[model samples]
Target: MSLEFELCLRRPFTLLAHEALLNIYYSASCLKKKAGEFLRPFGLTDVQFNLMMLLKYQSEQDEGLSQARLSSMMLVNRANITSLIDRMEKADLAIRTPAPADRRSNIVKLTGRGKELLAQIEPLYTKEVKRIMAALKLNEQKTVIEMLERIRGNVSEINENTTQDVSLVRA
Candidate 1:
């Protein structure tokens, strides 16, 4: 087994694997930077944009989303979402209203100003998304998305295992 492992290392497989990991990390960082640049004019970070979009979509159902639900949906802690909402509220982009049934919790809703800003930003956002998609052929784009989804699924599985381990340890 040791001799076989040594022979495998002599092949290009190890180098290719390292290069792939590096490429994935660099590509993700570059894309994030580009997205941040595109959103700079709107004074919105990626999380803020996600939150705003969430609220906008929720509004269509004639329902508001609670902060706890938003935090869970965003995969962030409640305190982080609370702070983000506070800043957005100060910017007049959103409002936090007490939930009718849950007085202790608040629902986040987009304000009129937020709706106007979203409208103004929609074109630029759409253009950026189009530009990203244009970089790849249809098949390549689909493959890329599928590959990313697989990676995400694997990571989630690992997280679940880790969580279970921690719970077992505590018990």
Candidate 2:
């Protein structure tokens, strides 16, 4: 069924671009909710699962990623990392240790339990991802990626300009 029909819209979108944006947002929300339901049985949220997987692969270096680096890599606020890490640590999925080079900074490490859980979840996750991706042909996937990148680039540029204007107003 069309998103317009599903949403029960009385009027048609005036512009294709408007409809596309709304469709992308609506689909992403639904996908996230479904994924959350899938993850809940393992006692982990989607974000926690993602972080564990990242650490499992990225832990080539001793002690894995520093809190600052993890925050930057995950595009999350540094202030939130402490609480997230704390929960993971409590669950015995991860640990934070003092950085070898930087005394003030703490590095994150995945625990054995985290690795085991990730290994269990990865197959199901990969299958789900592939199932969703199979909806589009390979060429269509590439085109979608390109279009999304262009949208992000244009929006980022406009956001940066708006920030500059706000700074100028403040100054």
lDDT of each: 0.84, 0.89
Worst 10 residues of 2 by lDDT: 54-63
Q: Tens digit of lDDT per residue, candidate 2, span 76-120?
A: 998788889999999999989998898999989888898888889
RMSD in order of candidates: 6.7, 1.5
Top TM-score hit: 2
For candidate 1, lDDT tens digit of each residue in 1-171? 332263455655456656566567867787889889888888998778888888888555637689999999899998899999999999999999999997999988888898899889888898888898897899999999899899789889999999999999999
Model 1: lowest-lDDT 10 consecutive positions: 1-10
Instruction: List TM-score per model, in order.
Output: 0.81, 0.93
In model 1, what lDDT does residue 93 have?
Answer: 91
Model 1: per-residue Cα lDDT at residue 155: 87
